[model samples]
Target chain A: MLRYLAKKLITLVALLFFVSITVFAVLFVLPGDPAQIILGINATPEALAALRADLGLDKSFWGQYREWVGNLLAGRSHHSIHYKMPVFDLIVDSLAVTGPMALMAMGFAVLISLPLGIYAARNQNRHGDVTVMFFTQLGLATPEFWFGILLILLLSVQLGWFSAGGFPGWAADPIGAFKALLLPAFALGVIRAAILTRLTRSSMLEVLREDYVRTARAKGLRERSVIYVHALRNALIPVLTIMGLQLGQLLAGAIIIENVYFLPGLGRLVFNAIGQRDLPVVRDIVLFMAAAVVVVNFVIDVAYAYVDPRIKIN
Target chain B: MNTPLLGIEELSVGFDTPEGKARAVDRVSFALERGETLGVVGESGCGKSVTALSILGLVPSPPGVIESGAIRFENSDLIGSPPEALRRIRGRDIAMIFQEPMTSLNPVLPIGRQVAEPLMVHRGLNRKEALDQAAQWLERVKIPDARRRMGDYPHHLSGGMRQRVMIAMAMVCRPKLLIADEPTTALDVTIQAQILALMVGLKQEMGMSLLLITHNLGVVAQMAARVVVMYAGQVVEEAVVSELFGRPFHPYTRGLLRSMPDPAGRPDGGSRRLSEIPGIVPAITEAIVGCKFAGRCPHAFGRCREQAPGLFDIAGGQRARCWLSRFPERRRTDA
Candidate 1:
C-alpha cells in the first residue's frame, strides 16, 4: 500500500507539472497583453515598460515560467495587477469561502443521491422507482444557475426565508455565512445528485444480481442488511469514482453559481482575474483546480484498495 | 412416523418472460427426514436448483415466483410466510450453499466475516465470539491456518478452499436442514470427491438433514441414501438409492443410469461410446398435456403421450411415475 501511494504521488506530481505548463502557456497564447490591458494604450512607453518589468512580462517565456514556478514552490506569490494583492493570499481567502460551500454541496449531493438511488434500485420497475427517476430527470435537465435563481425567487423573494444574495464574513457570523451558502450549495447539489443518483441506481441494480447477494439472503440477513451492507458496499465503488470527479467539477465550475449568489469564492476570483488579465491569479487558480482533480482521483484509487480486498496494489 | 424435517407439497415455481410464464418446477413434491440426505438429481434446466432455492425462500422474484406450493419446515409453512418469519428461519433453522463457490461469497468481505455473519444475524453472537466459532468451523472444513486466513478475502482462496469456506459458512449456525445445490460441480474431479466426503462427514457430525441437489448420478450414489430423479421440471421417480440404481422403474431413470459413462472399456479392447438419453428436455414454456418426459422416452407409446403418469407407490418403498410399474405385462407391448 505504501508503494502504491508513492507511485500515485509521482503520477500526481507529473500530472500537475503538465497542468501548470498548459495553464501558463494557454494564457500567453491568448490574444492579450497583460501590461497593455492593465495600463491604457495612451500611457507613455516608460510607464508601460515599468509595468511590464514589474509584472515580469519583460522576461522571456522560459524565464517567466521558471520564476513563476519558483515563487509558487516557495509559497510566495506575484502581485495581482488587477486586485493589487498577493495572488496566494487572494486565493486562500477565496478558498475559505469556496472550500466549505463546495464541500457542503458535495455533502448534500451524496446525502440526497444515496437514499434516492437505493430506493429506486430496490423498487425498480415500480411506482417508487418511476417517481424517483422522474425527479432525478428533472434535476438533471435544470441548470444549476437557473436552479439557484429559482431558489432565490421562492425562498428569498417570496417566502422571506433567506436573503437574496451576498455573503457575510465568516468571522462576524458563522451561522449567517452557512445560511448564505445553503441555497447556492443546494442548487449545485441538485444537478450532481441527479447524475449520482442515476449512477448509484444502475450500479446497485448490477450488484443486486451478484451471487453473494443471494448468499446473503440465504443467510437470513434482513432485506435491509442485504441491500445496504452487502450490495451497497460493492455498488459504492463506481459511485466513489464519479463522486471524486464531481467534486473536482464543483470546484472548477462554481464560477457561475458563485457569481449568481455573490459568494466571494475561487470561481469569482478567477473570473475577475481572467477579465483583467491577472496572469498569476488565473494561472494559479486553473492549476489549483487541475491539481484538485488529480489529487482527488489519487485518493479515490487508494480508497478502492481499502474497500475491496481483492484489489492488491503492488 | 414423525413428520419429515422438510416437506414440499405440490410446489410449482415459474418465471415470467417475454415469451410467457415458464414453469421451472412443476408441482414438485418431496420430503426430507431428520439426519437424512435426499438427493434431487436431474439434467440442466430440470429445476433441481429451483427446488433447493424454494426451500429457503431465496428464489429470485420478478422473473421467478412460487406459482403454488407449501414448504413445511418443522411445523410452519414457509411458502407465503411473511418475509420476516422466513428470514428468522433462514441461516438459523435452515441454510443453503450454491454451485459456484467463487461467486457465492462477497468479494469485498473477509471470508471469516462472511462465515461468521449468520451466527451474528441469527444467534446474536457478537463479532468476536462469532469469529472464534467461525475459525473452528473453518478448521473443521480442513482449511489450513483457519484463524490466519480469516482476514483474507474470497479471491485469496483456491476454488476447493472457497467451497470449504462456503460449507463452513452454511454449517456455522448448525441449521436443522442444509440445502446444498450442485455444491461441488465446479471443482476438480479430485476436489469434488473431497468436498462430497467433507459434506457427508459434516452432516453426520451435525446430525442435520441434507438436501443435496445435483445432476451427477455418481455424486447422488455417493452422498444420498434416497434419490429423486427429475425430468423436465417434474419428479419422474424416487426410491432408495440402491433400488433406483438397481431396478429403476421409470424409463427416464433407466435412461439416466444408462447414460453414466462406463470407465471400463468394451471387452474387445475397443473404445466404447457412452450411451446418452436421446432428445433434449422439453422447454418449460411449451405446455405439455401428457408426461413431460414422454417425448424423450424410448418406450414412449400411445398412452404415454395421451396421458400423464402419476407418481405411483411401487413395492419396497420405491415410487415410479410410469404405467409399466402398475402392470409389468404392458412393457411387452409397443404403442
Candidate 2:
C-alpha cells in the first residue's frame, strides 16, 4: 500500500510539473502585453521596454519560464501587480478563506445528501423518492450561479436574514463568522448536495438490488439496518467517486460564487489576478488548486480500500 | 405422526402487475411434520420460492397479495399475523435460507454478524453472546476456523462457505422449521453434497423440520422424506420420496424423473429411448381452463384439455393431479 501511494505521489508531482509548464506557456503566448496594461495609456515604446525589462518580460520565453520556476522553487518573494502584495502571501491568505469554505460546503453536501439519497432509494417509487428526485433534477438543471443569486435575493435582500455578501473572521467572532459563512456555504452546498443525492440514490438503488441486501433482509434485520448498513456501504463507492470529483468542481464554482458574494477567498484572488494579468499570482493559485485536487483524489483512492476490502492496491 | 409442524391449506399468492393480477401460487397446500424434510421441486417461475416467501409473510404486499391462505405453524395462524408478531416468529419459530448464497448473504457485513443477526433480533442476545452462538453455528455448518473467520466479510468466503454461513444464520435461532430455498444450487457438486450433509446433520441434531426447495431430483432423493412436485403454480404430485421415485403419477413429475441423468449408469443404459416430455410449461398469464401441464402431456385428452385436474389421493400417503389417475383403464391404455 505504501509503495502504491508513493507511486501515486510521484505521478501527481509529474502531473503538476506538466500543468505548470502549460499554464506558463499559455500566459506567455497570449497577445496582450501585461506591461502596457500595467502602464497608463500615455506610455511610450521606451517606457514599455523599460517596464518589460523590469518585469523580466524582456527574457526569452523559455528563459522567463525557467527563472519563474526557479524563483518559485527557491521561495524568492514576488510582488502581485493586482493586489500589490507578495504573490505567495496572497495565495496563502486566499487559501485560508477558500479552503475552509470548500470543505464546509462539501461537509454540508455530504451530511444532507447521504441520508436523503438513502431515504429516497429505500422508499423508491414512493412520494419521498419522487420529491427528492424532482429537487435533485432541479438542482442539476439550475446553474450554481443562479442558485447563489436566488439565495442572495431571498435570504439577504428580501428576508434580511443574512448580510448580502462578505466573510467575517471566525477567529475574531465565531458566531458572527458562522452566520456569515452559512449563506455562501448553503449556496455552494445545495447544488453539490443535489448532485451527490442523485448519485447516492441511484447507486443505493442499484446496490439494494444486489443479492447481499436480500441476505440482510433474510437475516431478519430491521429495514433501516438493511438499507443503511448493508446497502449503503457498497453504494458509497460511486458516491465517494462523485464526491471527490465534486470537490474540485466546488473549488471552480467558488470563483463565481465568491465574486457574487464578495468573499475574500482564493477564487476571488484568482479572478482578480486574471483581470490584472498577474501571472505570478495566477500560476501559484492554479498550482495550489491543482495540488488540492490531486491530494483529494489520492485521499479518496485510499478511502476506497477502507470502505471496500475487495479493492487491493498492488 | 405427531401433528404437522407446519400446514399450509389452500394457499394462493397473486401479484398486481401492470398487465393484470397474476396468480403465482394457486391453492398450494402441503404439510411438514416435525424433523421431516419435505422437498419442493419445481422449474423457474413455478412459484416454489414464492410459496416459501409467502409462508414467512416475506412476500411484498400491495403488488404481491396473498389472496387467501392459512399458514398454520404448530396450529398458530401465521397468514394474517401482525408485522411485530410475525417478526418474532420469522427468525425464532421459523427461519429461511435463500437461493444464490452470494446474493443471499449481505456482502458488507461479516459472516459472523450475518449469522448472529437473527440471534440478536429474536433471542435478544448482545453482540458478544450472539457472536459466540454464531461461531458455534458456524462450527455446526462445518466452516473451518470459525472463530477467526467470523470477522471476514461474506465476499471473502467461497460459494460453499457463504452458503454454510447462510445455513448457520438460519439455524442459529434454533427455529422449529427451516426453509432452505435452493440453498446449494449455486455450489459445485461436491460442495452441494457437503451442504446437504451439513443440513442433514444439523436438522437431526436440532430436530428441526426442513422445507427444501430445489429443481434437482438428486437433492430431493437424498435429503427429502416427502416430495412435493410443483408445476405452473400448483402441486402436480406429492408423495413419499421412495414412492415418488418409484412411481411418479403426474406427467410433469414423470418428465422431471425422466430428465434426471442416472447417476449410477450412463444416460443410455438400456432404458428404451430415454423419456422426453414434449413442450414447455404453459405461461401463468395464459388462462388455465384445463390442466396446466396438458399442453406438454402426451396422454392429454378432451377432458384433460377442457378441465383442470385437482390433486387427488392415489394410494396411502401419495397424491397426484392428473386425469389419467382417475381412470386406471386410461392409464393402462396409455401404457
Candidate 3:
C-alpha cells in the first residue's frame, strides 16, 4: 500500500509537469503578445521591445519554461500584465471563491444523488423510477448558467431572499458569503446531480441483482439495510469514479455559472485573463485547475482501493 | 402425525420473461421432518434451486412471482405471511446457502461481519457480542486464525473457505432448517466431500433439519435420508435413500443411477461407456400434454404421451410418477 501511494504520488507529479508544459506551450503558440496587449496597440516598436525584454519574452522557450517553473516552485510569482498584481495572489483570491463554491456544489450533488439514485434503482422500471428519470433528464438538459439564472429569478428577484449575483467575501461576513454562493452552488449541483443520479441508478440497479444481494436478503436484512448498506456500498464504487472526474470538471468548468452569478472564481479569473491576455495569471490558473483534476483523481484511486478490497494496490 | 419442521405444499413459482411466464417450479410439495435431511434431486432447470428459494421467500421479484403455494413452517404458512413476519423467520427459523460460494458472499463486507449480521438482526446481539460470537462461528467452521481473519474480506478466502464462511453465516443464527442449494456444486471433489461432511456434522451437532438440493445423486445417497427426484419442474419420484437407490421405481430415477460412472471401472479391464439420459429437460414454458419426462423415457408409450401421470405409491414406501411403476406388465405388453 505504501508502494502504491508512492507510485501514485510520483504519477501526480509527472502529470502536473506535463500539464504545466502544455499550459505554457499553448500560451507560447497563441497569437496575442502579452507585452503588446499590456502596452496597447499604439505603443512604439521600441516600447514593445523593451517590455518584451523585461517580461523575458525574448528568451528561448526552454529558458522561459525553466524560469517560469523555477519561480513557481520558489514561490516567486510573475506579475499579472493586466492587474499589475502578483499572479499567485490573484489566483489565491480566485481560489478562495471557487474552492468553497465547488466543494458546496459537490456536497449538494452527492447529497441529492445518493438517495435519489438508490430510490430510483430500488423502484427500477416503476413509477418512482420513471419520475426520477424524468427530472434527471430535464436537469441534464438544462445548462448550469441557465439554471443559475432561474434560481436568481426565483430566489433573488421574486422571493427577495438573496442578492442576484456576486460574492461577499467570507472574512467580511460568513453568513452572507454562504447565502451568496448557495444559489450558484445549487445551480451547479442540480446539473451535476442529474448526471450522478443516472449513474447511481444504473450502477445500483446492476449491483442489486448480484448474488450477494440475494444472500443479504436471505440473511433477513431489512429491505432498507439491503438496499442502502449492501447494495449502495457496492454501487458507490462506480459513482465515486464519476464523482472524482465530475469534481474536477466542476472546478474548471464552472466558468459560465461563475459568470452568471458574477462571482470572481478561478474560472472567471481565467476568463478575464484570456481576454486581456494576462498570460501569467491565465497560465498559473489553468495549471491549478489541471492539477486539481489530477489530484482529485489520485485521491479517488486511493479511495477506490479502500472501497473494494478486491483491488489490492500492489 | 407430528408437524414437519418445514412443509412446502403445492408450491408453484413462475418468472415473467419477454416471451411469456416461464413456470420454474410447478406444484412441488415436500417436507423435512425435525432433524431430518431431505434431498431434492434434479438436473439443471428442474426447479430444485427455485424450490429452495421459494422456501426462504427470497425469490427475486418482478422477474419471479409465486403463483400459488403454502410454505408451512412451525404450523404457520410463510407464503401468506407479511414481509416483516417472513423476514423475522428468515435467518432465524430458516437460513439458506447458495451454490456459488464465490459470488454468494458480499465481497465488500468482512466475513466476520457477514456471519455476525444475523445475530445483530434477529438475535439482537450488540456489535461486540456479535463479533465475539461471529469469531466463534468462524472457528466452528474451522477457519484458521479466526480472530485475526475477522477483518479479512471474502476474496481473501479460497472457494472451500468461502463456502465455509457461508455456512458459518447461515448457521450462526442456529436456524432450525438450513436450505443448501447445490452447496458443493462449484467445488473440487475433495472440497465437495469435505463441505458435505462438515454440513452433515454441523446439522447433527445443531439438531437442525436440512433441505439439500443437488443434481448429484451420489450426494443425495450420502447426505439425505429421504429424496425427491424432479424433472421439468415436477416431482418424478420420492423415496427413502435406500429404497430409491436399491429398487428405483421411476425410469428417470433408474436412468439417473445408470448414468453414474462406475468408480471401479469395468471388471474385464475394458473401458465401458457410462449411460446418459438422452434429451434435455423440457423448458417450463412449453405446454406439455403428458408426463414431462416421457420424451426422454426409453419406455415411453402412447398413454405416456397422451396422459400425464401423477405421483403413484409403490412398494417400500416409495412413490413414482410412471405408468410402468403402476403396472409391471406394461413393458411386456409394449414388447
Chain B TM-score per candidate, please.
Answer: 0.96, 0.95, 0.97
Q: What is the DockQ of each candidate?
A: 0.85, 0.54, 0.87
Model 2 in CAPRI terms: which quality?
medium
In model 1, what is the error at residue A163, expressed in angstroms? Answer: 2.1
Q: For candidate 1, lDDT tens digit of each residue in A1-314? A: 78977888898789889998888889878788888888888888899899889878899989999999999889887788888888889988898889888889999999999999999999999999999999999998998999999999999999988989989979998999999999999999888999999999999999999999999999999898899889999999999998989888776749999999998999999999999888888998888888788877877777888888777787
Q: What is the lDDT of residue A89 in candidate 3?
A: 89
**Interface Cα RMSD of candidate 2:** 1.7
Error of 2 at A303 (Å): 1.8
Over the stretch A1-314, how does candidate 2's per-residue lDDT look in tens digits?
A: 88998898898889889989999988888777888889977899999999899889999989998998888889886788766889878877776677777888999899999999989987888999999999999988987778888999998899999888887776787777777767778878888999899899999989977877766666667777777788989999989998888887666438888888888888888888887888888887788788888888888888888898778775
Off by over 4 Å in 3: B266-271, B332-335
Candidate 1 interface CA RMSD, Å: 0.7
Q: How far off is residue B251 in model 3, in Å? A: 1.4
Residue B193, candidate 1: Cα error in Å is 1.5
The TM-score of predicted model 3 comes to: 0.97
TM-score of each: 0.96, 0.95, 0.97
Per-residue error (Å), model 2, residue A122:
2.7
Residue pairs in clash, model 3: none
- Residues B158-241 of candidate 3 have per-residue lDDT tens digits of 999999999999998899999999999999999999999999999999999999999998899999999999988888899999
Fraction of native contacts, model 3: 0.84
Task: Encode model 2's per-residue lDDT on B53-97: one tens digit a residue.
Answer: 898888866579999979998878888788767767887888898
Rank all candidate structures by their lDDT, best first, as comma-separated numbers: 3, 1, 2
Candidate 1: tens digits of C-alpha lDDT, residues B1-335: 89999989999999998889899999999999999999999999999999888888888898899989899999789997998999999998899989999999999999999999999999899999999999999999999999999999999999999999999999998999999999999999999999999998999989999999999999999989999999888998999999999988888888788788867867898866777888888888999877888787767667888888899999788988887776677664332
